[model samples]
Target: METTQNTFEQFKLNRQLLNAIEEAGYTTPTPIQEQAIPLALAGQDILGIAQTGTGKTAAYALPLLMRIKYAQGQHARALIMAPTRELAMQISEAIIQLSKYTDIRTVVLFGGVGPKSQIEAIRDGVDIIVATPGRFMDLYFREEVTVKHLNVMILDEADKMMDMGFMPQIRKLLEIIPVKRQNMLFSATFSEKVERLSHEFLEFPTRIEVTPQATTAEMVSQTLYELPNFHTKMNLLSHLLRDEEVFNRVLIFTRSREVAGLVHQYLLGRVVREDALRVIHANKGQNTRTNAMEAFREGSVRVMVATDVVSRGIDITEVSHVINFDVPLMYEDYVHRIGRTGRANHVGQAITFMTFADEYHIRKIEKMIRMEIPRTKLPAEIEMMETPRNEMQDMLREIDNQKRKEDPTFLGAFHEKKAYRPPSKFNQKDSRARRGASSRTKKR
Candidate 1:
C-alpha cells in the first residue's frame, strides 16, 4: 500500500492498521505524528519532542504496530517504557485500540500489582509490552520476559523516567536489548539528561519537535489568582466548580499527596454527587487509582484531584479545565499540568491559584513558558484572608534565601544552624546536690 503525501494514509501501513487509524478518526496527522510516523515506519529511530496529549502515542505506536505485522513469539517484539503505571497503561491502551483489527497482542507491566498475570500473558505470547522500568526489569530478571526478539523500543516521557530515577534500570535495559533494534524517545521537554539518554540509547535518531521546549499548548488560556491563603483558594475553587459549564470535566493539580487528599475530601464532602469526584495520589491503591482515572475518562466523574503523579502521565481528553490548586514546586510541571487540559487541538482553560509564597515559583514557571499567567481579580463575594502562619514562614524563608544569595553572611532560618550548648551549671549542680542528698538519706 504505497501512499502519496501528507496524510496518515500516506504511510504504507498494513490494511488493519490503516483501517484502525481511519476508525480512530485521525484524518490529518498532528505535527509530531506527521513528522514521526513516516520516519518510524521506515525503521528509523525517532526523538520526538512533544507533550503528553500531542498525539505522540500515535506518532510512534501507529508506525510500530504497523511494523510488527503479526504476533508470533512468546517474547515481546517491541517494548515501551514509561515512568508511571497510568502512562504505561495508557500507551498499551492506545496500541490495543490501533491494532484492534490485528492479532498483535500487548501486555502492560507495572509494579503495584502481582506479576503473575503479566508473566502468564507474556508466556502466552505477546508482540508488544508497555511497562515501567522496575516491573519490566523484574520480569526480565525472573526469566519470564526477554528482549532478544525486540525490533522496536520506545521510551515515552523520557524526561519523567529520568526525573523518577529510572536511569539505572533504563541503562541496564539498554545493555540487555538487541543492539540492532530501532529506538525512539519522546519527551515534552528536552534537557541535558534527555540528550545524554538519547545519545546512549538512540542511534542516529531523527529528531521531531512539534512544539518548542517547555512551551505550553497554544490552545490553553492561562489564568492566575493571587489568593492570600489556602482557605481563600479553596473558597475560590468551590465558587468556580459551581459553574458546571466552565468547570466540567476538570482536573485539579496540587503539589503534595496531603493537599491532593485535602482538596479531594473538601470537594467530595461538598459536592452532592459523590460519584462525580475522585482523587489519586501515591497512597491510593492501584485499583482505586485506575478506577478513579477510568471513571474520570468516562465522564462518570466530573472532578479529579491529583498530585503531580499523573501530571505528565495520564491522558484524559475533553478536560475542560485544569486548576492548579497549588503552584507546582517543579516549574516544568506547570507545563505538564496545563497540558492535561489543552489537548488534541482543543481550547481549554488553566487556572492557577497563587499564594504569596508561590510568587517566587510562578516566576520560574512563567519564564519557562515564555509568558506570565494573566491575573484575574477574585470575586467580590469571596472574602480574602490573611497570610497563614506556614505561608508567612515560607515567604520569610524565601526572602532569606534571596538575601543570602546576595551575601552568604546573611542569616536566614534555613541557613542558620542552632548551636549546641552544654548543660547549665545550676541544673548540673542541682542534679549532683539531689543525688548526694539521696545518698545521705539512704546512709541514714
Candidate 2:
C-alpha cells in the first residue's frame, strides 16, 4: 500500500509493522518519528531530544521492530532501558502494541515486581527486553537475561536516569552490552549529562531534536496561580475540578509522597466523586501504583496525585490538564510534568500553584523554558487563606538563601524583622502535614 511520501510508509517498514502502526491509532508520524525513524532504519545511532506522550516511543520502537523483524535466538536481540518501572512497562507495552502485526516477542523486567514471571518470559523466548537499569542488571547477574545478541540498545529518559543516580549502573551495563549494537538515547531535556552519556554510548549518532530542549509543548496552554497558601490552592483546584471540569484526565504532581497522600485524602474527603481520585508515590506498592496509573489512563479515575516517581512513567497523552500542586524541586521536572498533557498535537492545559517559597524555583523553571508562564487570578469564590506560619517563614528563608548566594554578607530578612521569633518546635502540622516533607521546607 502506497502512503504519502512523508508518512511511515516512506521509511520502508514491513507491511505487518505498518498495519500495527495503523491499528495502534497512529495516523501520521510525529515530527520526531518522521525524522528519527529513517535514520534508525539506516542503522545509524540516534540521539533524540524529545519527551514521552509525543509518540517518541514508536520512533525508536518501530525501527527496532523492523530490524528485529521475527524472533531469532532465545536471548533478547534488542534491549531498551528506562529509569522507572512505569517507563519500562510503558515502552514494553508500546512495542507490543506497535508490533501487533508482526511476530516479535517482548518482555519487560523491573525491580518492583518479582522476577519469576519475567524469568519465565525470558526462558520462553523474547526478541526485545524493556527494563530498568537496576533490575536489568539484576536479571542479567541472575542468568535470566542477556544482551549477547543485542541488535539495538535504547535509552529512554536518559536525563531522568541520571537524576535518579543510575549513572554507575548505566556505565556498567554499557560495558556488558554487545559493543557493535546501534545506540539510541531519547530524552525530553538535552542536559549536559545526557550529552556526555550520548558521546560515551552513541557512535557518531544522527542528532534529532524536534523542539528546543526543556521547551513546553506548544499545544499546552500553561498558566500559573500565585496562591498564598495550600488551602487556597486546594480551593482553586476544587473549583476547577468540580465547577469547571477544567481537567478530565488530570495528573497532579507534588514534591513529596506525603503530600501526595495528603492531597489525595483532602480531595477524597471533600470532593463528591471520591472514586475519581487516587494517589501514588514511592510508598505505594508497585501493583497499587500500576493500578492507579492504569485507572487514570482508562478514565476510571479522573485525577492521579503522584510524586516525581510517576511523572516520567505516565504514558497517556489525552490528559486534559496537568496541575503542579507544588512547584517541583528540580526545575527540569516542570517540563516533563506538563508534557503529560497536550501530547500528539492535542491541545491541553498545565496549571501550577505557587507559594512564596516556590517562587525561587518558579523563576528558574521560567528561565529554563525561556517563556513566562502566563498568570491567572484565583477565583473570588475560593477564600484566600493566610500563609501558614511555617510556610511563610520557609518562603522568607528561601529568599534569604538566594540573597546570600548572591551576596555573602546579607543576613536573612526575618532576622531584621520582629526580633526573629523562633519557629514553634511543635509545628508538626507544618512539617508533617505539608506533604510529610523534610524540615527545610517546613520553615516556610
Candidate 3:
C-alpha cells in the first residue's frame, strides 16, 4: 500500500494532537505508524513487528490517545506495559504529548523510585497507564488500580519483557484485565515467545511484520574489524575519530557498564572536548541516562558509550555512526545497536570491533541472522594470542578496577542506597568456632 501524502491529515487526528505532532516536527508517519494507526483506530487487535527506532511508540500511542479521547469510559481505559522503566517513561511521555488536546491523564509507574507519587497519581484517576511489570503489579496488589474497565491493552517490547523475566508478571496482569479489550503486541523481533504471547493474548489480530525477524536496518552500513586481544581499542577508536568527518553524533556499545565507563574515560582524555563525550548505562540511574541522551540529541556530545540495558527505547535522530566496542552476545541486540544509527531513512554506519574470543558470538550472530558481516583489518598486533574465554571474567574485573581509578564517582551512585545483604544462619556457630580456634592457638 502507498503511504498517504500526510498521515496526520489522512488519520483525521484532532487539531490539538496534529498541532502537537507538527510542533514536535513530525508531519509524515513512520512505516509502522502508517500501517498500525488505521487498524488500531478501527478497534482491531494488532500484532506489529518492527525494528527498534522505527517510531513504533507513536504508531500505538497516537491511535490509543485518539480512541481514549473520543470514546467514553472509566477504570483506566488503557494499560501499556513496557519491559523497562526507561521505556515506560518514554511511552508515557509520548502518550502525554499526543493526549494534550484532551483531558486524558497518563500515569507512569516503574521501579527504582518512590511508589507514593505513583499511587497518588493512580488514585486520582488516569485514562492511560504506562508501566513496568514489576511496579505495576505492586500497585495492583495494593488495590490502587483496577482493569475491569480497561478498553485497550498494549505490550510494547514484548520480546524484551520476556528476556527480563516479566512473563509471569504479564500473565498475572492479563488475568486481571477484562477479556473484551483491544490488544496490541508490538515487538522488535518475532521470537517464539512473542508468537506464543500473541497467540494467547490477541484474538484474530491483524498481523504486520515490517522487517525480517533478525534483519538489521537496511540503511545501516555494517562492517567488522579483526582486532587482536592485546591491541588497545582506545587507540583504534581514537584513530577513527581523528577522521573529523565522523564527529557530531556517534554511539559506542559495550558489554558492560564498566567497559562503557572505561571507554568514556579514554575518550574524555583524548577527545580535546570533554563536553562532547559521555557514558550511559543501567547503573547510571535514570537522570544520568536521560542527560546523556539529551546531550547526544542536542549535538553537544560527539560520542556516547552505552550498555545493552540503555540500548532499548532510546530514540535519537541523525546518529552518524554506531560502534560496537564489544560484540553483543544476543543476535537481536546486534540489530537494535545498529538500528540506533540508521533511522528515519537516513544512511548511517555501524562498525564492530571483534577479538578472536568473540569468534563464537560472531558466528552465532551470523548463523541466527543468516548473513556474514564483512570484516576489515585491525590496527596492529595481528600475532597476539586470543584472550582465553575463561579469563573474560578476570578481564571484566580488571576493567572495573580501571574505571574506579579513572572515575572518582564510579561507585558513588551505588553507595547512596544499600543493596540486600541477608544475614547468615550459621553466624553464631561460626563465631564460636573461630573463638575456640583462637584459644587453642594461644595455648599452642
* TM-scores for all predictions: 0.89, 0.90, 0.81
Candidate 2: tens digits of C-alpha lDDT, residues 1-444: 855776777888899988888887777788898999989989999999886677788889988998988977788988899999888888888889988877789999888777888899999999999989998889888877877888688999999999999999999998988899889999888888988899899999889988888888788999998776677778888788784355678888999988888788888958737788898988788899888888888888988889998877476868998999999988889988888888767899899997766767889999999999898865645555555778777777877898898899997787785644333431224434444343356666
- Model 2 alpha-carbon drift over 4 Å, by segment: 1-3, 407-411, 414-444
Candidate number achieving the greatest lDDT relative to the actual structure: 1
> lDDT score of model 2?
0.83
lDDT by residue (tens digit), candidate 1, 53-166: 778899888888878888786778999999999899988988999999989999999999888988888888899999999999998899898889988889999998888899
Clashing pairs in 3: none
Give the per-residue Cα lDDT of candidate 1 at 359: 73
The alpha-carbon lDDT assigned to residue 334 of candidate 1 equals 90
lDDT, candidate 1, residue 401?
Answer: 75
Question: Residue 356 deviation, candidate 3, in Å?
Answer: 1.6
Candidate 3 at residue 149, lDDT?
86
Pull out the clashing pairs in model 1. Answer: none
Q: Lowest-scoring 10 consecutive residues by lDDT in candidate 1?
A: 419-428
